[model samples]
Target: MPDTRYTFLDTPIGALLLAGADERLRCIGFPTGKGAVTPRADWHRDDAAFAEARRQLSAYFEGRLTRFDLDLDPRGTPFQRAVWEELTCIPPGETISYGALARRIGRPSASRAVGAANGANPLPIVVPCHRVIGAAGSLTGFAGGLDTKKWLLALERGATSRVSEQLSLL
Candidate 1:
């Protein structure tokens, strides 16, 4: 199966699942659907990528960086990969509707399909699934839940200082 090894990182938002194979990161997502950070039990214990991830995440949470420069290996079909590739082009702090994203990928009629790919994104914050909102500008489905989506949006909007208080409910 996926040769991915993983680790958990405690962040201002919550626990982040960092998965990589060798030097290439595969995914980064919320752990346990909760904001509580915890350690991962099984993974490549000494992976260098994990160390780099910790640094990058620290910079991100501190608002020192706006975009990530990490290698990604999200598992999916060709079509889904295409959709995700487009998702990555969406700049930080900016958002697009699912329909808009589908249009960007030249699949204008595949808005719902785009949503599926967004939901299936193994890398959330890094790949920026949070940038895709409902057509009506509503925060929609997120594997980490709506509150996390809200928090991410706020963080991108220069509200990192409030993340600790916002995440306390989770």
Candidate 2:
């Protein structure tokens, strides 16, 4: 059967559709345009777990929290899990190139494969996938689009003030 626990969050970046299984958060995505996605009406709280997730997420959005402290159950292959695990180790304000991440995971020759896994990350911001960049020190593809990706990276480094000026909508 499908997971049942879910919630809709109004975040600084957009509306997030949060789904989970008991205490483990499964996915966090912006379904509609920024701040437009809403949780399913059938979304019923999982009591203890849901409350904790909401609390952590609230802290994150307000920029009070740098790292999350909740269980995550993102669905993916073993390689993807390795990639995500490596991503979590990336310091909050720092970033790593796909090649660097692959080398850290003991697969230096698999940079392209690592890039693929990063792109396939089931969870975006929560997993900190935005911290990964191209080998040439350039930004790359993001499921949420390049603008959102740049916003996230800038937010992490406290460098978003400039983007806010360039993009009035931010």
Prediction 1 global C-alpha lDDT: 0.78
Model 2, residue pairs in steric clash: 14-35, 15-35
Residue-level lDDT tens digits of model 2 in 55-137:
87788666678898888888899999999999999988688899999999999999999988987786778788889898888
lDDT of 1 by residue, 1-170 (tens): 53557677778766687877765777776765632324355555544556877788889887787788877777899988998888789888889999999999999999999999988887788888888999999888887888778877788889855765856756
Q: Would you list the clashing residue pairs of candidate 1?
A: none
Which candidate leads the pack in lDDT? Answer: 1
